[model samples]
Structure formats: C-alpha cells, structure tokens
Target: MLKKVRGTRKKATLGHIRQETVYLAIQALQKDESLSIQLLCEIAGIARSSYYKWLNRKPSACELENEQLTQVMLSIYEKVERTFGYRQLTLHMRKQTGKKINHKRVYRLMKLRGIQSVIRRKRAKYVRSTPQQVAENVLNRKFEATAPNEKWVTNVTEFKYGHGQKAYLSAILDLHDKSIVSYVLGHSNNNPLVFQTLKQALQAAPGSKPMLHSDRGFQYTSLDFKKLLDKNELFQSMSRVGRCIDNGPMESFWGTLKCEKYYLHKYETFQDLKKDVENYIHFYNNERLQAKLNGLSPMEFRNKAA
Candidate 1:
C-alpha cells in the first residue's frame, strides 16, 4: 500500500482515515520530535479514519487519462489562438494525438477547464429588392457543387470605419470549394462594385455558363447587369423576397469572417481595415481549418481534389 498520495489527490477522506495521512502525521512528529498525533489531526482538521482512507485510495486509469486530456486541450486551444469551438478542437485533438474521442467529452473537458472559442452574435442586413420580377430560383438553396464554377453566389457587405466613413465589399463565392473566386471593394455600394466582382470571377474561373446566383438587389436586377449575364451566357438565379436563407452559405461566410477576425481588432482607417480583410481572405483560403473541410483549408481541399 502507498504511504503517501501525490499532490494532485483530493483532500477529502470520508469513511476510514488514510494511511497517507497517518504517515504524514508520523513524519511530522519525527521531524519536530514534539508534535503529537492529536495535535496534528487537530491542526489539519482531518479525522484519523478519513486520513487513513485517503492514503489507501488509488486512482483509476480513466481518471488519470482525463488529466492528460485536459493538458492536450489547453495546448491545442492556445496553438490556434482559440479560433475553434469544441467541434473543430476535437478534430485537431484527435488528429494530433491519434486518440479517438467522443465529441461530447471534448465539450465537457473544455467547459470544465474554461477553454472556449470566442462567441460572437450575428445579425441580418440586406438591401431592399426591386419591384420588378427578378430571376427565378433555379438553385433553390441547393448549395452543393461537384466541380468548381458549377454554381456561384455573389453579395455585397458594408463596413464602417473612421467615424461614419463607409466602404462596400462585393465578393463571388464558388459552391464547390467555398472559395472566394473574386472580390472588389469601393466607396459606392452600387452597380460598379458588383460588376467588377462578377467580371473578375468570370475571368478567374471561366466556367461553362455557370449559374450565377444573388438576391434581387437593384444592382443585380439592373438592365446592364442582366445584359452582362446574357452576353456571357451566364445563367442568373435570385432569392425570393425576405428569404436570406436562400443565400445561407454566403451569409455564414460573412459571420465567420467577422467573428474570427474582424470583431477582434480595432480598425482606425479604411485602408488598414481593407488590408486586414484582404489578409484574412487569404488566410481563410490557405490556413484556416474547417470542420466541414475534413481538417483541410479551402485551398488545400481544392488542390487535393485536383
């Protein structure tokens, strides 16, 4: 039987006293040569039976493994700068440690240790649609694509900096890789920004008349925009009025970008914010790991497929 417990052992000894506690009291008397067991137990406030029981108790294998797991969780959480929630953290843990873990246990361990990702709330924002009829919902919330450029989604989001100053970002996303094929930023949230993004996407991907989808914003419904689509033989699709979920993937991307990077920083100028946004897009494509992507970045997944 062990005479002493490691420092990590619980101090609570209920039933009989522990051998470790009795040994401790004896050792103290040996060192001091004057303190009695009664005085030691009185000062320690542990009954003799409780101290004896604690010293005799041995840790189970499962309990020992849990301590190890907590350390691993802390290592990975700091390594990623705490960008991942429990799901992604579980993936990283399993990948690095080669240990199969139930995700619920990971969640529990993270909670117990107070290790968690930053939680940021999302809100809905949109431009009002035009009165005229827009393109039909050909895609109809079917976001999957087997090949690049098979389906493309486009949208513009607004950003503010420098006290009431504003900027707009127009981006085109490919359904297959969830990659931003092209993007453009401008002071005006108008036809020019969208057109530039669309044209760049066309040049970059050069798909076989891919279905270009968007909401029925006035920029999308404009005669020139439709003519541009018609001229390029790009089929157009639109979300119905008041249904942002029709563009769920695109909306989710904005929220992820904001939560992971944007909301964490203080941007004093449009130029500084724009540069960081550009850097984040690159990182999202090449460095950031996604749970849906099977632990690969978007570019890594696409390249692996190729």
Candidate 2:
C-alpha cells in the first residue's frame, strides 16, 4: 500500500450490523460440514433461544395468503402476453374472475415477480411544415355541428409494418355526428387518395358543402385538392402549422384509434389492416358512445338530429 489508512475509515463501513451478522452466519454455515441451531446462533452473534423460536414458529396466515395471490397474478400475467400492468390486471381479475383484490396487493405481487408491461417506443417521423403563405383559420376551432355535413375535419395519418412499407390513411369526419364521412387507405401519400376520400365524403354528404378543415398537408394544399374544393363550393379551412389544438377533435379521434385499437392489434397485411379499420370505423359510428353526444353513438346522434 502507498500509505497506511487510519482514523474511523467510514468510507466502507457496513451499514447494518444485523445484516452483516446474517451474512456472516450464512457464510460460516456454507463452510461448515453440518449446520446446528446453536452453532448458527453463535456465528450470527444472536441468542440460541431466538433462533429456536424462529424455527418453531409457522408462517403467518397472511404470508400463506400472499403465496396464493401470487399464483393468481402469475396466471393472469401469462394469459395476457405479459402486457397487463397492475391496473389492467386488477380490472381483469375483478371482471373475469370476480375477485375483489386490492390494487396494492397486485402492485406488490407484480413487483415481486418482475412482471411488467411493454412500453412502445415513440418513433420520429417526417412532418411537413406549414407553408409560408398560411391560409386564414376560417373554422376557428368550432368543433360542434347541429347536423350532418355542416362541419368536417380531414387528416392524413401514416402507418407502417415490418420492412419499411408504409400506408397512409386519409379520412374526413363529420363533426355533427362524429362519424367518418369518407376514408381511404392507400400505399402512397399522394393527391389521388386525398381527392378520392373527398369525393366520397361529398357523395356521402349528398347536397351539402361542408366546411372542411385539415392540417396543411401537401395533399390538402395541392392544386388538384383546391380545384375540387372550389368546384364543389365547399369552404376550405386549414389548421395553423404544428397547432394540434386548432384541429383538436380530429386529433382526438386519431389518438383514440391508435391507442384503443391499433396499438393493441398487430396487422400482417394491408388488406387485414383495412378490414379491421373498416370494422372499427363502423363500430365507432354506429355503436361506440360519445360523451359529448349524451352517450349516444355517432349514428344515433345523426338520427337524433334528423
């Protein structure tokens, strides 16, 4: 050694005397040919009576109960692809098994077993910046409509699967009913898909020229899209660049679609994804409840308006 260290030398001092004694006793027993209660107590620096007391006592009822609870938690975790966290697991236990288990117990059990939900990593993607020649915000964030075809919001959202293949979903939602007036799923993020969706929305709206709102995606701002809007006599409204709140309702719809449906299910093919989307859209329009619509579905709201 370069120098002899003296003083208290607190840098590497053992934190707990009891823990150190326990570890030392374990080490001594491993080296010993046989273990005896008296010898263990001597090595642990504890009284022999205390060691005998621990050996004679049985596990508490609560300890036994925790073992049973842990088994149930393990079963539920295995059943759900290890994706259910404490809250979801608790909910599943109550609903599926009719067990009134405490959340704290579930949390403790999940922690003890090292069972955890997988978190999806956020991916960075290319977002088109708003053009320098920004349009006036005509819609002004008015999301409610008294009848179908009064207000509509359109947006393009991208999805990808496996090896670099991406698909764009362009859709128009009727604010009056919270229903998808039109939607198109396509391989390319081009004007054709956007125009096709708009055409379908116009057809669905029949005689109405709805105020169409959308983020300034190239598809929305293209000459062809503008010409179609002008020919249809529809009011065009663009959201301010990067201001999601300007088009909050459509953003909310997209979030719900991704979180509640898309994130949970994996698609192997574009057609499969399209079919699932179609089914979900139908359910959203005709069956899913909307709190703003007094808990009625989009189709119900439309019928009520009629």
Candidate 3:
C-alpha cells in the first residue's frame, strides 16, 4: 500500500513537468525567435532527448528578439531613403540605438533584404566648333612669358538654364602671370562677346601689344574680332583644329573655373551667375592658392614679380 502511494506521487510530478514544458513552448513561439523543439527544451531546462520527444514544438523568446532586430534594420533602411549601403546603415543604427554593431552583419542583412542604388548615365557630348580659317599657332604651346601682357589666351564658355535661356562667359587670361586680365558675361557667345573682352584686356594692360592665342572658334575668326586685335597691335595665335594643347593655359583656366566653383552650385538667374562668376574670378586672382605659382595666388605672384 505504501509503494502504490509513492508511484501515484511520481506520476503527478511527471504530469506537472509536461504541462510546464507546453507553456514554455507557447511563450517561445510568441517571442518570434527560432522556435524549434530543441530551442524550447533548452529554454525550459529539459534534455535534448526529451525535446525530440516533442519534435513538433515552436520558437522561443530569443528567436523572437532576433526577428525584431531584423525588422528594425529594415525600417532604418527605408527611413534613409534607401540610399544608404550597409556601411552608412550600420552607422545610422549605432547612432540611433547607442549600440555598436558589426558592419558585416549589417551588410548581410541588406543583401538578404535586396537593397540597391540607381545608376545614372551620361546625357550628351559637346561637339568642337569648326572654323572657316585657322589662325597661326604663334606661341607654339610656350606657356611662360618674362613680362606681364607678353602672352595672353582667350576663350568662351556657356552656362545653360532650363530650356532655352543661357549665358556666355568670355575671358582673356595673361599667361605670363596666369591672371584673368579681362572677362565679360553676355547673352550670346559671338564675335562681339569676345571682342568686348579683348578690348577690356587691352585697355587694362596699357602700352602692351600681347601675343593673344585662342582656339579655332568662330568668334575668334570673325572679321570684327581680328580688326580689333589689329587695332590694338596684338598678334594673333590659334590652336590647331581639335588640339587643346596649343591653348593649354586658357583651357586650364576654364577647367579650374568650372570644377572648383561653377559645377558645385546651381544658378537661378543670369545676373546671379554673373555676380558669382566675378566673385570667383576675384578669389582666384587674390585668394585661392595655385600650385603652379608656388602656392601663391595669381595676384600675389604678379605683385611680387612687380
């Protein structure tokens, strides 16, 4: 009779253990972690052998927490406008949560979630203008001059607005000191445009008939432009067709202007663009340092020379 009573107590205890196991498995499933029979057994302090007995069990609290982290990562990617790759996303996560996470983990998450960026292609190419008559290559790529106004190169470039409106920029650069002797902004890039720039340059450098060089653009070949050069007693030089090397200094000036300042900002009106261009030219001459001038600005180097 005592042995039978002991057996009954043992059976009741086993029944209680099974009920607790079922309750833990349900809790694990709600938590969203990888809920398997094995994980549930581990959470409930049961043996692996015992877990296999309940092979069709659900997820535990740990698995649920892992799923929540993934959802949070996805939300972050969406919030950043989908532009951020894994590195940036990882940084964002750390900043938001104050928790340091590995970049590789973030990358893997992004890959699994299929994140990417859109690629853009070039729009159009500029065609070089063909001139009726080519001018002589007088300077022959010699960029240096001993005195101011000895050698000058001129060029014009255009900036576009929405559909049809545009502004033209003409510049005359003194190659000797690499200074912008004169510049003009106009509605059209024509003979009048460049001739006006040349007139200003000639007036600025009084008593000097500089050897002026330019590309074979039509503006440079126009009769009015040539007559003005003749009137000032300045010799005319030109680059060979499609050969930018002949007017390398002027080309370099254009490159520096566009790359350093103009390309970075969008101009709303022609006048605003003109004002900014003037400001940049002033800065280029007076403030901005040039490696070619031994770390001195054009104005500084020229002043020292004087």
Report the C-alpha displacement of residue 118, candidate 1, in angstroms: 2.8
Model 1 C-alpha RMSD to native: 9.4
| Tens digit per residue, CA lDDT, model 3, 145-207 | 998889999888877754558998999998867999999999997888888898788789788
Rank candidates by lDDT, best first.
1, 2, 3
**Between which residue pairs do clashes occur in model 3?**
28-59, 28-60, 31-64, 32-63, 32-64, 33-63, 33-64, 34-63, 35-58, 35-59
Cα displacement (angstroms), candidate 1, residue 207, comes to 4.5
What are the per-residue Cα lDDT tens digits for candidate 2 across 1-306?
324342233223332334434644554575685777567668667787665564466868975776777787778777545655677566555544566777766876666555777565453456685453335679999888877899999988887765667888899998887888899999998889999999998888788988999888887777777788889999889998778788888887777666545777777788878886788788678766565675567898888889
Q: After superposition, how far is residue 211 of candidate 1 from its true place, in Å?
A: 0.8
The lDDT, on a scale of 0 to 1, for candidate 1 is 0.79
Tens-digit lDDT track of model 1 for 1-306:
243563223333321124433455565674688766656666667676665565476857975786788788888787656767888778777877789977877876775555678887767566576445489989899998988778999888878778888888999888888888899978889999999999998888765678999988889989889999999999999998888899888988888877777777778898988997898899788777677777777898789877
Give candidate 2's error at residue 177 in angstroms: 1.7
Give the least accurate 10-residue stretch of model 3, judged by summed lDDT: 116-125
